[model samples]
Target: MTIREAFTDLINQRGWYVKLEIPEGTANSTKKRFLEGKPVTEDKMKEILQRAGYRIKQVELWEK
Candidate 1:
């Protein structure tokens, strides 16, 4: 299925808002930053989306 379709499925399954924050930084920079929300680990979100059959792209997570 298309990525958008997968995303829609995830939202429907969750039945609630799902906010994910990913850290973005280079080796020189140690500061933590988020793409969609505040600083947060990306791995944790991966686990949750696995069941939803969708993967986060562009460092943003899907919310219901």
Candidate 2:
């Protein structure tokens, strides 16, 4: 599947907006391309977070 197609799939699966912030000096090749407004395969999402020391945690949801 194409990169954009994969990203679309991820968005659908999550049912929420996914945003990954790359701190300064940590943008790898693929991530740099993504940050520079280029199309990046969504498969890199996991690797990016893993490299950045992020993990998934459940949190309470609130409706306001």
Candidate 3:
């Protein structure tokens, strides 16, 4: 699934919301953009997943 889809699912499953210290207008705008399927940065995605108690692992595969 796409990142946006996964993010949405996680948010729904965990009832997660952005609670930044920014102004209400900016926060609302960000939420709107996110719901509109705007692309999220990789770093931001990692941060969110980490905050949700998820761990990321990288594994290398070699082909013979």
Candidate 4:
């Protein structure tokens, strides 16, 4: 699944919260970017997911 999809699922299914560990406004902005089809860096995604207790297994790239 896409990182955005995964993150949304975590929020819906796991009840992930915006705790102090993640800088204020980061989660909201990240989610907004994902919804708006903006580019989200891998490092940022990794940091957010890792903080939420998830690890990325693999990443795939494609040319459209």
What lDDT score belongs to each candidate, Candidate 1 first?
Answer: 0.41, 0.47, 0.57, 0.67
lDDT tens digits, residues 1-64, model 3? 5545555665555225444334556545545667777855767765666676555555435798
Error of 2 at 52 (Å): 2.6
Candidate rank order under lDDT? 4, 3, 2, 1
TM-score-better candidate, 2 vs 3: 3
lDDT of 4 by residue, 1-64 (tens): 7777766676554335555255446766766686687988767776777787787788677798
Residue-by-residue lDDT tens digits, candidate 2, 1-64: 4444444444343312334454334444454466567866545665554444444454436798
lDDT of candidate 2? 0.47
lDDT, candidate 2, at 11: 36
What would the TM-score be for candidate 2 when compared with the true structure? 0.34
Q: Considering TM-score, which of the candidate structures 1 and 4 is the better prediction for this target?
A: 4
Runs in model 3 lying further than 4 Å from the true structure: 1-5, 18-31, 57-64
Q: Where's the lowest-lDDT run of ten residues in candidate 1? A: 23-32
On lDDT, the candidate that comes out on top is 4
Model 4 misplaced regions, further than 4 Å: 11-17, 58-64
The ten-residue window of minimal lDDT in model 2 covers: 9-18
Clash pairs for candidate 2: none
| 1-64 per-residue lDDT for model 1 (tens digits) | 5444553454454332334332223311212223334543445345546644465556656999
